[model samples]
Target: MTDDDPDRDIRCQDALQAAYRELVSAAIMAGWSEREVVLAIGELADKHLLSLETNDNADALIALLRRMT
Candidate 1:
């Protein structure tokens, strides 16, 4: 499939979700609390966001994070 194929986006999203679930499950099995796992994900997101240049997408991400609280 070409990069422009919309189906690719959906497939990628599905794959990402599966990987996320597996990682979270592994972390929990490793004795990390649910809250710890969530906090760790938030920290990772924060670090990635800091590297992004300011733009509407960044603003939207920040807003979404705020809404989660």
Candidate 2:
């Protein structure tokens, strides 16, 4: 992956995720089920990867949080 490569953005993202795999493990260690961890990671899609309807994702997060209580 290089600056000129169109897939560089996503390539670097994968590399970063590999480096952060421990963080994901830590979330699971903290008692978060795998499904909850996946949902939390999916939330980051709106924040970083796909920026469409950001607020809608946020609203859904809030709703999920409310349901947890």
Candidate 3:
């Protein structure tokens, strides 16, 4: 198990960046325009901010999204 090391946050940020790169590559391959991806990511950020403001479970946000679809 990884301890609460000093560099933990940096490591996590690096991992997230790698994952984001992979996802963006796949999305481009799937014909998503850069603008669309940016807009969608902004929308996701907005939803997460709303969740934080309401002190709600992020899973509830996912459920709400499923309902919208």
lDDT of each: 0.87, 0.83, 0.83
Clashing pairs in 1: none
lDDT of candidate 1 over 1-69, digit per residue (tens): 799997998988787998888888899999999889989988998978766756667899999999999
Question: What CA root-mean-square deviation does each model show from the true structure?
Answer: 10.6, 11.8, 9.5
Clashes of 3: 0
**Colliding pairs, model 3:** none
Clash totals in order: 0, 0, 0
Candidate 1 regions exceeding 4 Å error are: 1-12, 54-69
Per-residue lDDT tens digits for candidate 3, residues 1-69, read 277788988888787997887877788889999778878877998999997877667668988999999
What residue runs in model 3 are displaced by over 4 Å at the alpha carbon? 1-12, 56-69
Those runs of model 2 whose alpha carbons end farther than 4 Å from true positions after fitting are: 48-69
Residue pairs that clash (backbone atoms under 3 angstroms), model 2: none
The residue-level lDDT of candidate 3 at 28 comes to: 81
lDDT of 2 by residue, 1-69 (tens): 467999998888888987568877999999999788888888886577556677679989999999999
Q: Pick the candidate with the highest TM-score.
A: 3
Candidates 1 and 2 compared: the better one by TM-score is 1
